[model samples]
Target: DKKVVLITGCSSGIGLSLAVRLASDPNKTFKVYATMRNLAKKERLLESVKGLHKDTLDILQMDVTDRQSILDARDRVVEKRVDILVCNAGVGLMGPLELQSLDTMRQILEVNLFGTIQTIQAFLPEMKAQGQGRILVTGSTGGLHGLPFNEVYCASKFAIEGACESLAVLLQHFNIHVSLIECGPVNTDFLVNLQKVELGDTSLEQLDTHTLGLYEKYLQHCDSVFQNAAQDTEDIVKVFLDAIQSPSPLFRYFTSGVVPPLTQLKITQPDGSQCIRSMSKIIFSSEEK
Candidate 1:
């Protein structure tokens, strides 16, 4: 029997790479429903799978924020019985928290948190009926700890971490598995595509104008010290594969080399305060040099 997989946010980056990799496997019978917000933007996705096996990859339209799109996608794949569901669609918001708009925060939470919940709701019952399935979510290193200029993005991912943790317990009885992939900074267009939301009349701007100055100084320093810190997309894809295939997969898989050390420090260090303190010193101390 062929396993059916549905992945959201397949227009580019890790989602696109995963879809391509899965399609290349000849032994494992797969029908991959690669989904994105806009079908037109998936030219690259289409092009990547062009020469490979026919009918193995199907590109579908899905906007995580819209219920209608989710329902439509569900209808298309309802017959196949999805064996795996990858909630990979997410947006990043960069800049000081004080400079962020309420709308921006809402949008991030909507897509990264509520959107993931909706996806689980729409698909979990089907998986339960089938008796076995896997759910992989793209969490971030930021979800493990806070980062400057990415409070909203981190908050949304943090929510995902919590949601998936609870989901693991809730779905265990049904023989379904839920896992979170805490990926590091991969060389992707994720940062480039962040949506800019205008902050309305508020004290946030005044606070941002002050903090932005500090952040600008720190960013310049971090950029120099962390020039070689980016992770490869292929490495992340390998971790995703492991998570999906493991006989007894962990509740959380931290994909980056950096994340494990940081997570350990957070756990072992006394009071759990030194982790952030150390990170802050490394991140902001360059300004002094």
Candidate 2:
């Protein structure tokens, strides 16, 4: 039987790539329900899939922040059971914390933390009854360690880590696996889609000059990192495939293969000060170390 998989945020990036890969599987191993918040944006997903994968793929409209939409998507599943659930829908918010409004911060949490939890909540009962399932969440390095201007974004991802870890402990008893695919910068539209306070914007006019200087440096650092280190979405999908195929999948899979050096520092240096200093040097220092 083809494993029934439902993935959120299939409009683009890792989610789109994963959906395309699974739907195009030569062995026909998976039946994919690739969902996005806006079906209007599905043309890109469809275009990427190219040739017909009629039997293996279905596109559904699902707004992760809306409980009714999640439930509606679940109800539309012809198989009535999701063997694998991928909660990959999330957004990013960047800028100094002081510039962030309550509504903007709430929007980030709504989609990144609460949306993920809600998606899992909708599917948990059925998975429990089935006595076997896989839950894969798209996590971030920001979650493991903080970033300079991504305070709200990091908060949301960190919350997801907590939620997933708590669920993993209990779900193991039900033969269900919860895995977090921790990603670093990836070649995606995330930079374009994120809510950012740009330099010279009217909003920045009232902000302090020191903060403004740092923000400019952060932006440069961000561009350099993406140009030099961002992985393709295909690379991320491979890690997801490994997790899905494993009989005993690990709780966390780093897309870069091992914990990044900076992220590792957090574990080795529990004091937290060292990690902060290192990150500050990397982003704020005029010269890259």
Candidate 3:
């Protein structure tokens, strides 16, 4: 019996990569429902899976922020039985917090935090009743560390970190395993989508010079990380495969060498002040030199 695996955010990047990877499995281990916010953007996904494993994959329309879309998507899945649920949908918000509007911030939380919760709520009951299932979320090092301009993004991921950790314990009783795939930079458009300071925006014009300077430096820092050390999508799919296939998978899996040390600082230094200062130097200090 093939596992019915449903993944969100399949329009591009990791979600798309993972979906195609599993769907093309020669053994036919997975019946993949690759979902995204809009069906129109699915052309890329369609192109990737062409002539290969076409029967195993289905691209469905689902907006994580919309509960009805999620419910409708679930209803469309076979038996409504999602043996593995990958909450890969996320949005990025970067830039000076002051420059961001309340509406935009709410949208981030709605998609990244509340959206995840709502998706799980819709499918969790069925998983519980079935007595066994797997839930893998695309967590980030940002969830554990506070980055310079990614305050809201980090907060939303941090909330998910806590939620997944807490739920892992409760779900253990039901033979349902939960894993958070904590990764560093991956070769994806996600970084490209991070907030860029608009030259004509009046809001950014009001920020202090130092804040603006830091924002510029932070963007450079992030770009450097992505350019120099970002892993390919194939690299991350390997970790996902392990988490899904292993007889006993860990609660957290780190996908890149670059992210481990970033997460360790907080653990090694209890106060977390050292961790913050260290990161501050990485993003802000290099500009001095």
Candidate 4:
């Protein structure tokens, strides 16, 4: 019996890599449903897989933000049951909070928070009845700790942490496991895909000079971190595989293999001031602490 897996956001990044990897599994261990909001973008996924493994791979249209689309994709699942569900569809928003439009913020929450929950809601009943299942969420360090310009993005990820943790407590009773794969920067199109306030954008013209300076610094820091530290999507997929294969999978798997030094501050210093200072130093080191 091949494990039936459905992954959201298969147009690129971790989702595409995971889909290709699972479908190409030498043992043919998984039947993968690699879904995306736009099937038009599936050529990259198809190209990556080289048009092989028809039996192991299926593509479907799933716009996580749309309830009907999620249900429609679920109905198309030939197996009628998803043994593994990967909610990897998400977008990022960056800039000073004051400059972020309400609509843009709502869009982030729609896809990152509500969409993930909706997808899980659609599949929960069937998985519960099956007596076993795995739910893997692609989390972020931003969720676990604050970043300079990613307030809303972090909030959405943090919300998922709470949601998944709460569900884990109940799902254990059903022999289902819920895991969050907390990722740091990954070599993906996320930077390109995110909604960002660019330096040259006209909107920045009205912002205070101090904020403009900080935003520039933040962008530089972002580029440096991703250039030096971002992991490949393949690395992230391996952690997903670990969670899927483990008999007793952990509730949270850090792709870096251990807790990050900065993130550990949130745990070690509950007052939060210390963590705030540390993060500030990392991103705005040019300015005085």
The best candidate by TM-score is: 4
> Relative to the true structure, how large is the alpha-carbon lDDT of every model?
0.81, 0.95, 0.89, 0.95
TM-score winner, 2 or 4: 4
RMSD of each: 3.1, 1.3, 1.6, 0.7
Rank by TM-score (best first): 4, 2, 3, 1
Residue pairs in candidate 2 whose N, alpha carbon or C atoms collide under 3 angstroms: none
Candidate 4, run of 10 with poorest lDDT: 280-289
Compute the lDDT of residue 209 as modeled in candidate 4: 93
Better of 2 and 3 by TM-score: 2
> Residue by residue across 2-109, what tens digits does model 1's lDDT show?
678899999999999999888777675677889999999888987888867566888889999998899899899845588989999999887666566798789999
How do the residues 6-69 of candidate 3 rate in per-residue lDDT, one tens digit apiece? 9999998999999999999989989999999989999898888885776799889999999999
Instruction: Score residue 176 of candidate 4 by CA lDDT.
Output: 93
Better of 1 and 4 by TM-score: 4
Candidate 2, residues 1-289, lDDT tens digits: the string is: 9999999999989999999999999999999999999999999999998958999999999999999999999999999999999999989998988889999999999999999999999999999999999999999999999998999999999999999999999999999999999999999989888999988679898889888888899999999999999999999999999999998999999999999988899999999988988999999876434
**How well is each residue in 99-126 modelled by candidate 4, as lDDT tens digits?**
9999999999999999999999999999
The C-alpha stretches of model 3 lying farther than 4 A from their native spots are: 257-259, 286-289
Candidate 1 residues lying further than 4 Å off, grouped into runs, are 196-210, 221-227, 257-259, 287-289
Give the C-alpha miss distance for residue 204 in model 2, angstroms. 0.5
Q: lDDT value for candidate 1?
A: 0.81
